[model samples]
Target: MRVAFVSMTTTRHRDTEGNRRLERLAHQLADRGHDVTVFCAAWWDDYRDKRTIEGVTYHGVTVSPAPTSFAARLPVLLARYRPDVIHVRPRPPRAVFAASSGGTLARAPLVLEWYGDEELADSRTVRLLLREATAVVTPSEMVRTQVRERDVADERSHEIPDGIDFSLIEDTEPGEEIEVAFAHPLDEAANLDSLLLALAELRGRDWSVTVVGDGPLRPDYERQAADLRIDDRITFAGECSQQERIAIYRGAHTFVQTAYREYFARELLRALAAGCVGIVEYQAESSAHELIENHRRSFRVTDPQELADAIVESGDLERRTIDEDFARFDHRQILEAYLDLYRDVQESHGVL
Candidate 1:
């Protein structure tokens, strides 16, 4: 199958989880003998218009500040590619309109992917996209529920969770200190202040923390740690490479997340896969708690103190077992599901 993926950006332009996931999926599909082409905006370098990374081809569309110009060019681009199916990640409303129009022009089935809780307003543009889409895919049940409640798509909607590349997992011994790790941009929504306050509750405990990722609020978080008097015990490792992040997860004995909103907590899953005892705070917008399997080794806390307690008591619990059956999140399985969806859409729409 020849698949064309339309998104606003790619990992080369921005190192975001969504972009990374798209890049991984494109490569996986290509490795499985499916031709994959990704159409994205030229966000970074202006010199190159097209490039192939690994096995997947990437075509960069020069975006104008005006939405009208960008939307006008999308159909032309899509027609030039002439792919069998079009997969779109809708964020900006104009992009969705463009992809819908382009899919129609190319006579290809459109697959709209909802990755976050995007509140759909009652508008003609949204209705048109929903009506034209061959299938609506979401990364979690929470997102699918939102789509259904908003009447975005009917029985054509699917819940396909984001997957991890388990081959990246490396076996490593746990560190000496009861190292608790959390990786997120040091922004207000990260709720690092809560995590710091929780750690302060265990002042003299033989444990330390490694906070990965950096952002504009790093200085504020650093000051908060100093004020809590746990600065020495907490290390702000700043933004790390993917390998460094995996290594940190593998070495740590516990992983904790206190983000106020996370559409899908891939970091928590990675940590758990690396054998870390997971402890996630319950946030209405976050689905992090859904990943916890073993109640004894993992926990869902409501407050900072409970998070601290979970970290302390985690020592008594053995490392959570991740059996083959639990490894359904493997990217291979995810790709197969996507392939099946492509076939369904092609067959139903009578697209050869």
Candidate 2:
């Protein structure tokens, strides 16, 4: 199967969660011997129109992420590429319109990956995109529900979650054993205040924590931790690589998710796969709770007080170096789901 990925910028240019997910999907699909090509704005230094890196080819649609110019040129390029399915996102909005036109020209099914993080400044345009797309993929039911509110049919909207590497979790040696763990980029949306306050609730308990990731708000979070008087027991390890994080998750007994906004609780997934009892705080805008709703060793809370109680309670759960329960979320399994969706859509469209 040939896939034409339409995005104005990739991880190479934007390095966002959504872009990184697309990059992984493209490369993984290519690894399986499928012809995958990314139609994106040029990020390379050279003036070449296209380049192939890691088996997947990238066709530069524009020199930069110029929405107008990128939109104007996308339809013809996609029409020429003639992929079996056209996968895109709703970021630029105009680019989606261009992709729709190109899909119409190529008679290919248009699949939109709605991360639910992008702002919907124009509802009419979003509705049009939702109505026109052959299939709309979201990272979780929280996002799928939002997409369905725009009048998209149930069959047209699908929930495809973030993929995990179960093998990595199994192979990584445990890092410094800690009682509690939390991971997220320390930003305004991180909502680390909740975790800190929760830790404060466990003030007298014999416990320690490791906070991973860093950002502009690191200093603020550090100060908040100090003010809570739990800084002594906390280690703000700063940014750590995936291997480092997996090791920590493996050593820790529990992992908490308190981010104000999460399309998908990726770090929590890693922690859970590494056998950390998941503790998630419920937020209207976050889908973190979704990952833990079905797990026996998990709890969902709405505030720091509840979070603290859950953390203390999780000690009763058995420690595990790995939990095979999450094997379904492996990258290969998720890739197969994508292939299944593509084949199902292609069959409906008579493309295969």
Candidate 3:
């Protein structure tokens, strides 16, 4: 497949989840013997219009993150490339509009990845883009619903959660016995207090917790833990690598998801993949609960008391080092899903 990816920013410009996603997909497609090209505002230092890095080719549509100029130039370049599929990010809605024109000229179908964290430049433009896009990929049902609410056809929308490195989970041995595991940036939006209070509820019991990640709220969380007198039982390991996190999750019996807002619970996914009994607290602004919807080994709760109750209930569950069920979330499998979507779109558009 000849694929053209449209993203105004790369990890080089802004290391965001949205940017990293398109970047990874482009590279993966290229490595699979597909002709992949990324049309983005120039991240290259030279005056050249294009550059090849690794197996993927990058074609600069503008010299900077100038939305107007990038949109104006994107269509012609994409048309010239003659892509079979145009994979794009759903933000800066004007750019999606431009990519639509490019997709039209190239006889390609546009697939938009909606992480639900994008900064929609305008409401009208976003609606139009949602209506026109051949496929809108969301990482969670929460996002899929939001897109569909805009009157997009059901078949055109899909829920494809972010993939994880399941190999890491399988390869890394359990670090230590962690009865409870919680991983999230100790930031304002991260509802660490819920987990802390829940742990306080189980203070008299025999259990240990490993809280991964660090942020400005770390000191506050530490102080909160101390105040609750459950500080000794909880360890604030602070921003460990992915391998380290998987090890803890692999050892842990229960993993708590208590963040205020999450488009998708990535840390929870990692824990579940490692066989931790998932316990998610329902938050109005968060889509985290959607992950545990149908799973038998998971619990969806409302408050800290419910969180505590679920933790106690988790003790009865068997501990596992790894869960094979999550193999579908592997990066290789997800890349294949993208290929499948591309093939479907191509066949539908008579571009095969």
Candidate 4:
């Protein structure tokens, strides 16, 4: 099958979970003997032209860095590539344009892969645009519920959970020292301020706490850590590659996701795959709650004291249970899910 993926950016341009997802699906499809092409904005200064990477071809179309203007170029690229299936990743402005234009220009079925909240788009316009898509894919049941509640036709939407590439699972033994890590861009939404306060309560706890990933809120978080008087116990590791992140996850005894607006916590899964006990900030409506409820090895803690308590108790849970659940969503299974979705879209629309 010939598939064309349309996204605002590629993994090469920005090392984001979303970008990595697009790259993974594209490469997996290509490796399975499917013709796959990705259309993205020219996000890099050096590579403004079309090129191919690891069997997946890319068309780096130049457009406004903004999604609104970028949408205009998608149809032309879609018609040119003429793939059997046009798979679009989340970018509201572009989703609107792609769905609208694709309804007319595209001879193949159109699928929208939603990785984030698309609440930014005008609801009326998005509804009209969604009418154009043959299928809409979301990574979690929470996201699927959001799409369904948005009035997208039930038949057109499918809930396919986001998956991790378990190939990166390289677990290091719990060394003499254990580090509890919380990773995300330091920001107001990260709610790391509350987490820092929580960690401060663990003044003499045996474990060290590290915060990986960076953002504008770094200084504020650092200051908060100092105020809590646990600065010495905290270390900040900035953005990392696949291997580095997996290594960190392996080495750590616990992993925390403190974000408020996360759709699906991918990093937490990576940590679980690496045999780290997972702790999530408790939010009734958030994806984290669902994860902890279903996974016995996972815990949800709201206050800093509770967070620290969970970390302290993580040693009691069976690490193998945590590893087993994540292993189920390994890369090979993820690849097969994409293949099935592609085949469904193709057969439904007669693209094949």
- Across 80-175, the per-residue lDDT of candidate 1 in tens digits comes to 788889988665567777887888788888988877644457566565666557898878777777667657656788988788766675443333
lDDT of candidate model 2 versus the reference = 0.91
User: Which lDDT value does model 1 have at 320?
Assistant: 39
Candidate 4 clash figure, as a count: 1
Residues 283-344 of candidate 2 have per-residue lDDT tens digits of 99999988887899999898989998999899999987788999999999999999999998
Model 3 C-alpha lDDT per residue in residues 1-352, reported as the tens digit of each score:
7889999888888887778777888887888898989888888889998899988988888988988998898899889999889989866677889999999998889898888878766767778888778899988888888888877788999887788988888999998988989999889988999999988988889889999999999999999999999999889999999898998999899899999888878889899999999999998878888777878899999999999999999888888888788888998998888888889888888888
The best candidate in terms of TM-score: 2
- Report how far off residue 77 is in candidate 4 (Å): 4.8
In candidate 3, what residue range of length 10 has the lowest lDDT sum?
117-126
Worst 10 residues of 4 by lDDT: 170-179
Give the per-residue lDDT digits (tens) of candidate 4, residues 122-220.
776666656667788877778778778778877888876667776556443332234576777776668887677767777776668777788899988
Q: 241, model 1: CA deviation in Å?
A: 1.8
User: Going through the candidates in order, what is the number of backbone clashes in each?
Assistant: 0, 0, 0, 1
lDDT-best of 1 and 3: 3
List clashing residue pairs in candidate 1. Answer: none
Sorted by TM-score (best first), the order is: 2, 3, 1, 4
TM-score for each of the candidates:
0.86, 0.97, 0.96, 0.85
lDDT of each: 0.78, 0.91, 0.88, 0.72
**What are the runs in model 4 whose C-alpha is more than 4 Å off?**
8-19, 42-49, 60-77, 90-106, 117-119, 171-176, 318-322
lDDT of 3 at 314: 86
RMSD of each: 3.0, 1.2, 1.5, 3.3
What's the C-alpha lDDT at position 51 in model 3? 92
